[model samples]
Target chain A: MALSAVRAPKIQLRQVRKVFDAHEQGMVALQNVDLDVSANEFVTLVGASGCGKSTLLRIIGGLEYATRGDVLIDGHGVLGPGSDRAMVFQHYSLYPWLRVMENIKFSRRLQANRGELTSSEVEAASGRADALLNVMGLSNAADKYPNQLSGGMQQRVAIARALLPRPQVLLMDEPFGALDAQTREVMHDLILHVFKLERATIVFVTHDVEEAIYLGQRVVLMAPRPGRIDTIYRVPLPAQRHQDMKHAPEFLALKREILQRIRETSGMKTDLELLEKLSHSVSISSLRTQG
Target chain B: MHNFSFSRPARRPAWFAVRGQIGRREYWMLALVGLVVPLLLWWSLSASGLVTKVFMPGPADVWNRAVLWFREDDLLGDIGISVYRVVAAWGLSALIAIPLGLAIGTYRPVQALLEPLTDFIRYMPAVAFIPLVMLWIGITEGSKIAIIWIGTFFQMVLMVAEDVRRVPMAQIETAQTMGARRSEIVSLVLLPAAKPAILDTLRVTMGWAWTYLVVAELVAANSGLGYAILRAQRFLQTDKIFAGIIIIGLIGLLLDQLFRALHRKAFPWLYLR
Candidate 1:
């Protein structure tokens, strides 16, 4: 558990492919997807709706099995779902029957048998739940249920619940997609704050390009039609970045490039003038030309 | 620069205005009217002699009979016995049904094996099995309890099974990702998620169990409010009959309220809406 000893990628997916035959018509979700996510890295997977980014995240979270290839954590092949990985899904996956405080301590409570929960264990779990409630700014909602909260508040609780377990790798599938525009902005900052404080490896899946670039140290832009990683762009912002950085020349240029790549992958004509502006400013290449 | 303009706003009738949900205060207000109207109608008809005394007793006659039964006729004893039988039978049914339902609902092969048998038994009347139950266990207390068991067990099993099946798959998967074992999923995830609906199923089935109480009493030699009512019917004591009917209705209402209150207190998060 020492920080210095954890050097390699926290999670690795090699030659992973997923196909669905449960339906009458079979469909390929992902093909030949290879990704190496380093420790404490905030890597965002951005793509079109059918790009299988969620499927890739699910494979790592052990919710779905890859049809072919390997999913490894710290270099060991995953046999089934494990506690090392925690996932926050798009549908506000907090347990509806549990209160905010109880939801955050779900993992700890489950780890210990219910009737036999020791006093010391209860004290420790409660302490962690209290700290997380403050961190997520949900102290007032400690006793409230998920259904009683707003969509944004519910997602925050979900994030806190996932983080409570201190999972080695946190996998989120479009955690903020259901929020309103203003709430989404607040969540972006909250996620970055939690990421800095916890310093855990995170792989966030989203379809919003600007959000991917805004939060990710490395934005993995994926493409559809057998869902492959088309390119990866390293965000060139400083460590102490603010929302205003989104308007900077560097940020906009990278965003414009990724947007163009997305449009091209989806089989739409790329505007030549937009491409000229994107190419002029960036030093790091899209660097992922498919064979 | 921006310019401002004013125009008359359109209005709609009050009846077309829809509110989010009816508040508890408003609900109780309507319930008051609902209670008074039925009783007032009965009182007016009986007092005005629209129905003959031989057919229907006035409220006073029924009330006096109720007092006499409570004072002299062991009415409380009979009511207590009937309630005990229903409780024992329903409790037994729940004990067997909850676990069996969870199993049948979760595992496909278990469901396939038991569901057809359960479906067939529910439609067969419990009264039809009275003779068979007498042959097996004799026309003792066991037969009465058996009649109630036949009346409620299969339906309860099927209902609880449906409730367990309706628990979301995503919650179960989430529990697994949190390192929950196969058995842990049932205790922590499936049971808690289905708590509200399971309580509801028990509440509904309890009323059905009450409906079969008289049939269960019919098989026995003596005792219970149902036996008392049947004895009064043979003597043509319609006033006594009305008293028994009123007591049964009041008991059913009391039990329904108890379950409803328990539901509200146990799962306020669900009832808040």
Candidate 2:
């Protein structure tokens, strides 16, 4: 953090605010959000649904503009989505018509269409896509269509496609939110491995607290109802991480603290609290007698 | 088998159960029944003499007339001409509509300009345009093709546009974040994503074109199946009329099957088990 103060942060969000005019009142999706992601940093935004974490990420990706404030990358204001950033959405983002290998090379096709790539560059991009396919453990499924692959494999292909452009920033919105527990763990590790290898800054969004803590170097907790950042916690663990670290004391403490804070911020009643309220209103025996 | 069962729910029969699917063998059996039952009903009704044969010819009489038409008359030529008119007009409409639909669906400006006009034009029935088509293109093969075009083109453009628009927002947004331009998004993202659906739209509109065939051939045409049917109607050649109508129905069914086969071949991903 001290070093980033001297060197400019890779990305800067200064008082970013977004108001969606979907309702008559003009719903405030995000407000007063300021964040700095250092080069190669992995930041995760965690909150309940409607917290504007995803919307914030979209703003950074230039998919949506902030209703107020600035989004800067390398200290330059974002005009629109550029080649400098790539995003992997939760699911169904891969072009179903393109095969795995072809999907991975899709970015290059976009560049070629703009007359930005030479024939040699195109060939090199193809070779690099094959390498990415291997990295994602998707070499065997290279020739298959996305619909033919499992949800996990399709996400891997999406990640491979996003990484091909080698953008400075990678934004992911609950990339594993749809997977089973085991598959989610596998994806967590795979993404971290890719993050380290690619040396690109990542901003991940998830409602999964464990995911936010495990994958993020710093966890930014957000709150709903005119969404805004509540707190940012720096992970106390070492740089190199493993699955076992998730169960470590510091990790558990952070997780518990964040979970409690999220409940408070979102004003959601816990299961115990909800049950207590219900029991006070009516007893199980009363319903049994009626039955 | 522990005998823990109390009351067992009745199993749903495959044919009528909600969302139930049958194997290929069962499907073929059901399909054969579907076809034969309709034919049998028609035959039994005609044989019962509930309706005069002049209006509803017996299956045997129609079959004999069809055989005679094929062997003795220029039925082959008529079939060939009719098929050519539908294919040519529909093909022409497709060549324009597919791209125009893609444009209208992809760009708001294109949609604003073309969609309302196309919608308005489509509601004006193709049959109603016979007088205008005759006046504009004159009483020739061109007018027949024009009539078919008038029938199919406007509706096709709107359907194609709808197909393109139905492509998920995520696909386009993913492309955008990957540095795809507006035009690139259409060609690279929307076009390929909508291809399977666009093909489906084409298949449905091809059916529409066939429905318009008789309307199209109602103009100063003298060679096609529609022409043969009309001439048979004028002379009260009821059996020959039955033959013509049956032949057209068979041809339309064949075309529909060909489209399905093509869709399966071209978009194998859509049919993944």
Candidate 3:
């Protein structure tokens, strides 16, 4: 058998642009975005609040359409949401009426409703859901409601629900943003384990530089104000990562460089100066009140 | 260990404190106070002779009249007919309005077509439709039911729609990204997500349905509590009128409590505490 030269990208975006209210003074949420995700790549997008990173991910997921350019998944032009991609939102997004196991079963029901899975396949999906529940350490919470669990536990259920389908591409929009620092650290390791176990290409979006560096094989830095990708940095760490690697010199150096680039791109320096001025005035006003 | 004890444990932190929680015992005690104070006030004012018995009936007189009415008249039948009318009309309204509301809330075109029409008709007053309902259905049980339906249907449709609309958009998008078809999105995502709120709307609209009872029985009806109240008013049977009013209030309260219990039973997740 002849070997192929170049492996086709699992997900590809070429010259993508998104303009809200295009007929009027349009807001360009994303501009000229081009990227390729390999078969099992883990990519993290980091940016300020309005940097269009979330919008770009939504476009790729077919939750939103780009105004121009093409998004190709497995060389097919993207249309609407399909079974090949599953999204994990920062908000837990579990149906409150459904129990944890039922929530995981929902994706399978969707597939069954589409006639994509036969009866035996549907039964297999439930077994897979049980396996995922155990993997996420939520077997005890299988009968509990979403509101009965803590935020971290609910997010874990969401991750398990998304992974149950075994979609080729997993799109996560800051799944740990609402978690506390300690829980975020725990989730970082949990997600890395799942990524390795599932072997699915992940395009994760986050605002935390440390989180992006800790998780991504390549970090895509984005900028706001007509939101575009600014830089891409390859992590120089081994395939397997430890939590203590966050303090290594190479990690710190790359973190500092990306942090600086984000600040410059988002105009954080001028905003910081304005913030200092406001603090000085606030202190003076407080002293006057005390006097 | 230092023996530092205080008397009464800081006075139980002020019974009427803002947002303070009371135990079940205290809650029942306060609830009794709410009922007893009004009863005592009514008894005293009537006994003082400030108003004639023709105008105001004492509690004992009303209670005796209620007993007499129950034995001498078909009081239970009246209560049954009134309950049946409200329940039948409201059940019909729910059967129609819930689906219409779900459609309106789920689809933009349906909302555009129906919401304004519902808003406009809800203000027309169910009582005002009495003449037309009488002319159309002609002084029968159907007209009475129609009166209540006209009263509650529009308001219920809008409330149910709002409840469906309140289901978070995130839940719908989550379903979409999982490749759920439109029908699946409605049945699996929108319906289940909005169910508790829809049930709440049903409970509330059921109360509004009872408020139209008198207007419904006004259409030449001889049975039901509303007709009985009107008949007692003509003969200056003030005690019987008071009896009718109290029975209606009790029935309304009973229905409301039943709804509350049903809500708690159906959606245990919402009542974690």
Query: How do the residues A124-209 of candidate 1 rate in per-residue lDDT, one tens digit apiece?
Result: 77888888899999999999989999999999998898888788888888989888889999999999999999888999999888
Residue-level lDDT tens digits of model 1 in B1-273: 223434645433343246645657977988999998988888898999889987988888999999999999999899989999898899999999999998988888999999999999899989999999999999888788889989999999999999989887767877778888888988888888888898999999999898888889888649888888888899988989999988998999999999999999999888554
Q: Can you list each candidate's DockQ? A: 0.37, 0.72, 0.69
Residues B133-163, model 3: lDDT tens digits: 9889998899999999999999999999999
TM-score of 3: 0.93
lDDT of 3 by residue, A1-291 (tens): 122214788888999999998568999999999999998999999987899999999998999999999999988898998768999999848898888998988888777767888889988888898889998999899999999999999999999988888999999999999999999999999999999999999999999999999999999999998889999999999889899999999999999999888878987666577699899999999999999
What are the candidates' interface root-mean-square deviations? 1.6, 0.9, 1.4
**Candidate 3 Cα RMSD (Å):** 3.4
In terms of DockQ, the best-performing candidate is 2
Q: What's model 2's lDDT at B261?
A: 100
- Specify the poorest-scoring 10-residue window by lDDT in model 1 chain B: B8-17
By TM-score rank, best first, the candidates go: 3, 2, 1
**What is candidate 3's CA lDDT for residue A290?**
100
Write the residue-wise lDDT of candidate 2 on B43-145 in tens digits.
Answer: 9999999999898999999999989988988899999999999999999999999989999998899999989998988999888889988898899898999
